[model samples]
Target: MSRAKNPKYESMSLEELRANMEKSKKELEHAIHNKNILEQRKRIVERKERSHRLIVKGAEFEKAFPLSRDLEQEEVQDVMEQLQNSSYNKSIVRQVYIAALHKEQQQIAEAVERAEKGDDS
Candidate 1:
């Protein structure tokens, strides 16, 4: 025969009520621990995905300028930040690289010119 459901909790003895309260607290703590574990796993997955995307994008940027030196991870990260902060079109990755190179060259040339003038003085 099918067993009857447990009797109403209101009819339970004081000891029974205390036992139930302890059981309920344990269940609540277990549920909370599981929830925290799942959140940690989720964060780990998100971090891996972000790192993978950065690696792939950095490789793509390098591919576009095959003759140029490969960009270091820090340089790629800086460019990524700039791309995110600016309104430039994402497709112009090569152009961005070239522009940055030109700017660096200009800065170096200006510094050399100043140094030569100082030496002459």
Candidate 2:
């Protein structure tokens, strides 16, 4: 029988990563209870690797496209309420937020460029 190749954890979706973590936890527990030293060590290493992958993914996501923190509480609540009232999915909401943030940043950059070019008005 041929063995299946394991997929790389870094490329896994969040849900898949969580599932892998749960599986690794169970395997580690079983290895510990069975007193299998080799399996226990292997499971520990796998679990740590998965955890590191998750952390790196989170960091990359935050760095590449972060939500705006300048929004006031009232504005945030209003957006949340509107989103809740609509049938929009989480992905749609995320896209809207990212688009708004990108537009705002672009406007700021353009204004700065104009000011640097000696255009005070």
* lDDT values for all models: 0.83, 0.80
Model 2 lDDT-worst window of ten? 61-70
Residue 119 lDDT in candidate 1:
57
Tally clashing residue pairs in candidate 2: 0
lDDT (10s digit) by residue, model 2, range 1-121: 9977666865799999899899999999997887887878899999999999988965664565366346676875776577577766667878999999999999999999999999977
- Give candidate 2 regions above 4 Å deviation: 1-35, 68-121
Model 1 C-alpha lDDT per residue in residues 1-121, reported as the tens digit of each score? 9977667876999999999999999999999999999999999999999999988975777788563356676776786688677755655766888999999999888889989889532
| Alpha-carbon RMSD, each predicted model | 20.4, 20.4
Task: Choose the strongest candidate by lDDT.
Answer: 1
State the displacement of the C-alpha of residue 4, model 1, in Å, after optimal TM-score superposition: 23
Which stretches of model 1 miss by more than 4 angstroms?
1-7, 67-121
Clashes of each: 0, 0
